[model samples]
Target: MHVQGVDGAEESNDGSFVDLRRSQAGAFTRTQAMRCGISDKVLGRGVRARQLQRIHPGVYVDFTGPLPWETRVWCALLACGPGTALTGPTALRKYGVDGDWRDDRIHLAVPHTRRLDRKSSVVVSRHRDLPAILHRTRRPLTVRIEVALLLTAGAHRDVSRRAAVLLDACRQRRTTPHRILAELPALPSLAGRSTLRRILADASDGVQSFLEHAYLRRVERAHGLPHARRQVRATTEQGVVYRDTEYEPYGVIVELDGQAGHADSISRWRDMTRDNAAATSGKVTLRFGYQLVSDPCSAAIQVAAALQHRGWPGRPRRCSPACRL
Candidate 1:
C-alpha cells in the first residue's frame, strides 16, 4: 500500500500522468491511488517493463511505447528530481546551432553538489546557478556544449571568450553582433578586460561575423581596396600597374600599386617589394588602389564588365513582374 498525499487532479485511465511533462503544467498536491484507480501493486508492475520510466523518486511516465531524444531529456529531467533544466547544447540547438540535435544524448542540469548516476545515453554536468549576465526563460534550449562555453567565457580573455561572445550572441539574437557589453562577466584581469573591450568593439551587426567586420568594412569601402585579404595575394607587374580591386580572376595575381597604397613611402616600398616576391606563379592577382575604387560606381561597373568579358554571368536576374523571380 502506497502511503501518499492524495492530489485531486483528474488522472486518465491506465495511469498515464497527463498533467506532467507539458512545459507549464503541474498540480501542487499529490494524486490519490484510489481516485486514479491505480494500486501500489499495479504501479510496480508498470515500472519494470521499461514502460513507465521513473524520472525521480515520485514522478513516473506510463510510457505507451517509445520516446524521442528531447522527450528523453524531459523524462530524464523529471527523473533527476527538482530544480533541473535542460540548459546548454539542448537549448542552443533549439536556438540555432545548425546540426542534428537528436545526435546528442539529452543533457540535464543538477545542482553543483549532486552526484547523478551516469547512464549510456545521458551525459551529466554539474553547474552552479547561471551567472547574472545569463538569463533564463522557460526555455530548455541552452544544451550542454554552449553552457560549457559560457563557463569558459567567465574566465575572460583568450580565444574562448572571443569565440564565446560571438557564439553566445548568435545564439541569443539568432543574429550576429549582439550587444556584448551587457553580457560580459566581471573579470578582473587587465588583459582579459582589455580583450573583452576589443572583442565587443569589434562585434558586427553584419550578415556575417567570422569574416572580421573591420577588415570587411575596409574591403567594402569606396576607397583603396587591398588584396582580398586572405583570398588573393598581389605583386607589382613590371609592365603594368593596376588597382587592388582590379582582378584577372582566371590567373588570380593581385597587382600592388605601392605609390598610392599609403602615405608612408618608406613603409609602402618595403611592403610592395615583399608582396612582389610573394606573388610568383600559381596565384590569382587582384590589383587596385585609392583612386580606382574611390568612386564606388566605377569599381562595380568595371568588375561587372570585366567578369562579363570573361564569360561570367553579368546579367541581373530577369523576371516578369507576375512571376516575382
Candidate 2:
C-alpha cells in the first residue's frame, strides 16, 4: 500500500491512502484516514512527526500553526461525524451574510436521532427534518440559507436580534423573505414565530433591517404616519441607489442608518452624494441612526415635520400616552 504524506511528495509503504485531505482544507477525521487505508500506526507516526496536527479528538489537519476560519469549520464538521451540517450564525457567515450575526463556536445541525457529547467549541442542534434542510451538494456541508436564518433567529432571545438575522439575510441577498416564509411552516415551534411572520410580511414590501422594521412599526404605523415606499430605487450620479423610505408624493425620504455606521470613507461619501442629489431634486431627506431610531416617537415627529413641510397635510398621531408626537 502507498500513502502520500501531507508534504505532497513523501510516500510511505502503508495501506493505499487517497488524498481526500485537500478537499477538506487539509483536514480529515481519523475514520476518514482509515477509510483511505492509512493505518492507525501510520497516523500516529504522522502526528508524532508533526506532519499532522489534532484539532478535535478525531479531527486532524495536515499543517501546524493557526488554522483559518474555513479550516476550523471543516475540522468542527469532521469532529461532529457524518450527517451533520453547519447551521445558524456559522452557516450565515458561510452564506456571506455579514454583520453581527456570527458565532465563535461552530454551529451544527444533526438528525434528532443522532446524539453526541457536547464540546465547548461546538453548538449542536437536533432537528427532526434535518435531511430535508441540509444542502447536501454544498461543500463544507451547510444547511440552506433559509433554514440557517430561521434557526439563527430562533436561537436568539432578543426580538431585534432575531429580526436582524432574517432581515440581514435578505439585505445581503443571501435569501429572500418569500423563501424564508415558505420554510417557516416546516418549523412551527420556532421561537418568535408570529414576530418572524410579521417581519416577513413587511419584508415582502422591502423592509430590509431591524431598524427599518422599527421605523415601519413604531414610527409609521404606531404614530399613524403615511406609509412610505420602502427600498425605493432611484438612479443617481453615484449609480443606482435604494432609499430606505420614500414618501414620494410628499417629497420626503427617510434614511435609517444602522448602529455600526458607515463602513468606510467611500460609504460615507456615497451617502452624502445620495442625500445631496435628493436635496437637488427638491426632496427632503431625513437621516436617523440607532440613537434616534431607538426613540421611535421622536423619530416619527421629525419625519412628520419633514412630511408636513413637503406638503403632507396629515398630522402625526401620538402612538401612546407618553409619546411626544
Candidate 3:
C-alpha cells in the first residue's frame, strides 16, 4: 500500500520515510532493521508522526497500510514463514470473526516442525495443517481459519456457531471437547461440518483461541435441555429441514441463529420461510441467538415451558424479578 505523508502531504524521496512506506517482503526482523539503518530514534519518530505502528518485535506498519494492522499481521505470518498463519484469536480479530471484541495478542500458528524465537506480543505455534487456514483477501492475503471451516458447510448453523466459539476458545487457549460442545449451542444459524468436530478435538491448551469454553460449558452444556440428536433430518412439507436440536415428541426445535441467518439475504429468507412452516406444523420452536446460548436461561425457560406444555415436570421455574441475578 502507498504511504500518507504529514497532513495528507505527498511522500518525500528521503531515506527516512522509505522504510515506513515501502511494501515489505515480510515482517521486519531485528537483523533487517539494523541493516536498513533503522534505529530506536527513527522508530520513535515514525510512531510520533503516525507513520508506523509496532507489532511483535521489529515488525512495523506504515500509516498508508491497506488494512488496519495489516502490515504487522502479515509481518508475523511472513516472518514465521509458509506454514504459519495468524490463527485463533488473532485471526478472529483480523477477520472480524467476533465484532467489537478487542484482543491483546498476535496469535501465529506454525508447522510443528518449525522453531520460533522468544518474542513478546507474538505467540507462535505449530499445526499439521496450518496452510489450510490462510487465504488472500483484498490487496493483501490474510490467513483465516473460518475460510477453511466453510470449505464444506453442510453441518448447519448450530455447527458453525459452535465452530466460531470453538475457534475463539482455541484463540483464548481454553480448549476442551466438552467445553467446545457446550459453546456450540450459542452460535446460532452457523453452518457446520464434520471438520468442526475435528477442530474441537484438536484444541490447544496454553494457546488462546477466540472464546472461553469453560464459561460456555458450565452455563450451557451442564444444565442444557437434553436432545438425543444434535442434528436431525426431518422431512416435512417445508422440503427438508435439518434440525440441529430437537425436544423429541413435543417437537421443540431449537435453531442456532448464525451470521448467515442474519446477514445473507437468501439464508434469511429461507430461515423465515422455515420458521413459518414450523409454526404451521404442530411443532413449537424456540429460536435462540448467540447471547441466549451463552446464558441458556431464556432458552431454558422456553424449552421448559414447551416441555411443560407436553407434560414434562420438575423443571426450574422462571426467576422472580427480585431474585434475578
- Which candidate number maximizes TM-score? 2
**Residue-wise C-alpha lDDT for candidate 3, range 1-325, written one tens digit per residue:** 3323322322334343344345553244444454555566766676677666665566666553454465566676656655566655566565555433344656676776888886756777555554544565532334444442332122235553544555553454433454544534433433553556555653432212222232134223444444334446667676897754566766666666645468878888877777777778777776766665455555566666777787665454334443222
Model 1 scores a TM of 0.44
**TM, every model:** 0.44, 0.88, 0.43
lDDT of 2 by residue, 100-153 (tens): 854678898888998988776788988998878878698767888898888888
Sliding window of 10 residues with minimal summed lDDT for model 1: 24-33
Task: Provide the lDDT at 81 for model 2.
Answer: 86
lDDT agreement with native, every candidate: 0.44, 0.82, 0.52
TM value for model 2: 0.88
Q: Give the distance in Å from residue 92's predicted Cα in candidate 2 to where it truly belongs.
A: 1.8
Tens digit per residue, CA lDDT, model 1, 1-325 = 1122222334565443344434422211113333565565655665665545455445554454556555666666655656666654555554555532343766555667887776656666665543332335545424333343343344444453354445445535554433345444422322354555554555532212322333233333322332232233343554333323233453333343424346687757755654564456543334454443233344434444444555554342312233211
